[model samples]
Target: CKTIFPNLFLIIHRNIVSTVNLACPLDLKSIALQARNAEYNPKVLSYSAVIMRIREPRTTALIFSSGKMVCTGAKSEEQSRLAARKYARVVQKLGFPVKFLDFKIQNMVGSCDVCFPIRLEARAVSWIYRMVKPRIVLLIFVSGKVVLTGTVGI
Candidate 1:
């Protein structure tokens, strides 16, 4: 039964990063205080944006003051969108007019092992290699660890 489809490729999605526009201004300090799962630190340069997390989809979102949100850690495209919508709803509930707009998948990452060590040195590629397909980057390691990134969808 397993040999029937030898060409079947399994792309194990490790994570999906997506972006969405709320189309309205947001106050990071207010969101952090109102949303239980949201955190914001204005003094910290690394955490300039409000970080929000959801348990249902196990995704985290970075909410900027400009109403732009970046959602990450979803296993699939649908999951990413669902998580982003959830984040947007949370903001909307905080009394900010939220409009879900320009929702797009920024990057999709998939990882797989070839089951054998790869000779990356012979390839002489840089730390990261790009796939033949446009907008696809493959990070191949010597230990047979391959990461496929820069894809918009699964």
Candidate 2:
């Protein structure tokens, strides 16, 4: 579900996620051992990160040992922030001095159908010429479906 404003462009669905700094290093395996919802596999990609999930916003947080955490899959910016804070609190309660910092909304994706057919090839060329800024990535389908993603506002 997504919020809609009359003045804004059509948004079918949106994903708003945040990246936060935990301020202290973590022990991935220990976290996995302590938290029932967390899973860590050292054999997977050889990365030291704990995969965590929360059901309220139905998001996933990638908690890394380097004091960095990325939370994804929230439907709105507010939900993303709340979910991130919830995660930080969870970790803090788990005995880590997890201070929520640098909480940045990393990505928001929105899609809509124009209710008309489109020539994707022509649209792609046109969109490229239409001046894309630093962060946005867009995809246009022949069915006039559009997906736009960026770090900026939705």
Candidate 3:
């Protein structure tokens, strides 16, 4: 039987990172509401409800559909990870499970400095690398040695 039905579905998954610095006191609830109603491309099937959470006294979360999330007003990488982990847990608790997409720490201080010291950063980096497990291209900084890890998708 030949039937006319939509067979192809394109799911565009995007994750965005943003930052906000507020000078004066603001209403978090109202701000979140405004973000919730903010428009996006018409091709978007639907905009997911914005999930707002406070990472600390400064940071806030604005989560959207398809695992897209933005952590705003964070000061440090520690703060960013804290917010992202909290948001990820909340999404999981809400029964929306998504594979770890991308973990980024923006607006960070010195390139060498991190929430935790080098050891901890190495461990977390290793863990995330294993989790996402993307193809890695290694470049030797000083010597001519290279280490390649993870599986590449072709």
Q: Which candidate is the best by lDDT?
A: 1
- Is candidate 2 or 3 superior in lDDT? 2
Model 1, 19-98: lDDT tens per residue?
99999999999999999888898787666799999998999999999999999999988999999999999999999999
TM-score of every candidate relative to the true structure: 0.86, 0.84, 0.37
Query: Which of the numbered candidates is closest to the native, going by highest TM-score?
Result: 1
Off by over 4 Å in 2: 1-8, 121-130
- Candidate 1: lDDT of 29? 94
lDDT of 3: 0.41
The stretch of ten residues in a row with the least summed lDDT in candidate 2 is 122-131
Evaluated at residue 5, the lDDT of candidate 1 is 47
lDDT of model 1 at residue 91?
A: 95
Candidate 2 has a TM-score of 0.84
TM-score of candidate 1 versus the correct structure, residues matched by position: 0.86
Each model's number of backbone clashes?
A: 0, 0, 0
Compute the lDDT of residue 117 as modeled in candidate 2. Answer: 66
Clash pairs detected, candidate 1: none
